[model samples]
Target: MRIMTYNVHVWYDNDGQFKLQEMIDLIKLLKPDLLCLQEITKHGLTEFVKQTGFTKVFKYHSVAILTNIENVEELSPPSNTRNYYPRFATVKVPLGDGKEFFLTCVHLDYKVETNRMKEIKQIKKHLSCLNADAAQVWAGDFNALTLEDYSDVVLNEITSVRRKNNWEMPKNDVSTTMKADGFECSWALVDRPPPVSTCRFDTHIDYIYINQDFRKIFEVTKVEHHGSTASDHSPVIADFKLIQTDDTEEESGDQ
Candidate 1:
């Protein structure tokens, strides 16, 4: 299976031009089996699906799913909080022949730490409800840099300073989403040749996480940082395979 995670920056390029149609074209070219998009507005989502022939999960929020393969069985919108937009969505897709997969698309809060924490908690709660046992892929613009980055006192201080200045500081931590003990970030687990910058500004924020139990079945075959003018944040692609199957059941597997 091929999957991608991208934060289109609402189809705005680094040059500050809004090219929603160009973004759609890029997604069509990738042709991921499942796609997780962030920063999508209602109009932009409609325009994307219309152009790329992908279906949008029925919801009133930014996160959307675009896939040429698989049938969408369920979609759960992000939990509502007073200060933040619904920037996350979860979908269950049937891979085929009774097999299925779970895809969670998320865009973390870009502002207050309190709000960011709340959003993460909400996301965890929703994922827990899904009973995601089959190959699960959680991807999108996390806004958080990495778990290591959160240890920097300077970064935390910068966040405090931004809060005082009425500027929203981006949360840079992976611990927020690791409520389950065995979850692992795909980029960190695989032996990446080296860190290739993804964002136009040369930052690595977007990511893909899979449950550790599924790691052996899915390998990070390829990961590319598209520096094209499609969107501010480059797209990430991952390939997976089913290595083992429980002989106990064939059709009614968990996803």
Candidate 2:
């Protein structure tokens, strides 16, 4: 399956132009089987569904999960706290005939690293409560750099920029926390240089991560940035191939 995570910058481009139609067109062109979006509004969601024909959708505030697949089930969010609602959502998606995987999408707190870390923990807690052993994929705008992307040179540049803008210091706590909890970044599996910026900030923040168990089922064949001028952040797309099955390992996959 081709899964994509995109932050629409609230339907505006990097140049601050509202490109609702362009956004819809871009999604059509990409044709992701499972699409997760951040910074999306209600109006945009409605128009996207109408024009793109995504039959199933789950929206929580600005974040949403859109899929055209049938018989997939939407999972319930944790009732303990409403703090993460606006930025997070999840669904149980079918893998094949009788198998399924949990897919969670999130738009973490953008301002502070600590806040983003807290949100990651909340997501992990919620997912653990649902089912810990299920294959899982979590993707969307994390708004914080991963520690692996923070090299000596990149760290210097990022820190200088943040300090000058009076923004909080850059930290990898959010992605690190997720990594510690058993999630593996899809981008990391592909052989590529690090620190490819997803947003205008010149920092790599947007991501797609799958748990180790998911890796056992699907092989990440490709991961790339589907950049579009219509949005500030490029869509991170990952292609997966089913590596093992009860009958035979098959290459059948879709976007």
Candidate 3:
């Protein structure tokens, strides 16, 4: 499975110019099975679906999902916290073997950390009502930083990314979201290093996470984040191999 998440910087270039084609071309080059896009405008939505010809497209306010896979149904976010604009979208994806997984693409409030925390909590709440028992993946621009982020770029890294000394349950929304029963950061699963920066701000905010149920059945082969002239936020890509059988699992995976 090739999964990607990006915040297209409101579908504009740095000089306040729209570079929709460049963004489209970049996505075409990646050709991910599932794409989670944030900060997309109506124009972007129209252009992407037209160009990609993806079988199903799900829209939740500004965030959108572009996928060629079939059996994708758009779901709703939590109504209780949907007072303001929706920061995320809920989509169910079928695995083709009588299995399905819920994917929640999130782009929390970028301007404030408190608001992001509130929104993330709501996202989890909404997921709880859904069939979380099956595989689940939450991918997008979290905007929430880890404790390792001491730079002023982010709010002292609101969450705990990982334990340096001993294992401790993190209190930040990132940790809370992953600890919600059976989730783990996707980047950590791979032996390769993830891109250092995901956007012009040099902040690695974008991410992809799959639940524990997929750990044994899946292996992340590659993860990369690259800058793009088309948008301020860089593109993030993660390629994975879903091994269903023991013999097929031994096949060499993408590097």
Evaluated with TM-score, which candidate comes out highest? 2
lDDT of 2 at 192: 41
Q: To one decimal, what is the Cα RMSD in angstroms of model 2 from the true structure?
A: 3.0
In model 1, what are the clashing residue pairs, if there are any? 145-172
lDDT of 3 by residue, 151-175 (tens): 4444333223333433232335664
Ranking according to lDDT, highest score first? 2, 3, 1
TM-score of each: 0.77, 0.91, 0.81
Task: State the C-alpha lDDT per candidate.
Answer: 0.68, 0.83, 0.73
CA-RMSD of model 3: 6.6
Encode model 2's per-residue lDDT on 108-159: one tens digit a residue: 8878988877777777777776566788999999888875665689889888
For candidate 3, the TM-score is 0.81
Question: Which parts of model 1 are misplaced by more than 4 Å?
Answer: 56-59, 79-84, 112-114, 132-134, 147-172, 176-180, 244-255
Better of 1 and 3 by lDDT: 3
The local distance difference test score of model 1 is 0.68
| lDDT measured at residue 88 in model 1 versus the true structure, 0 to 100 | 72
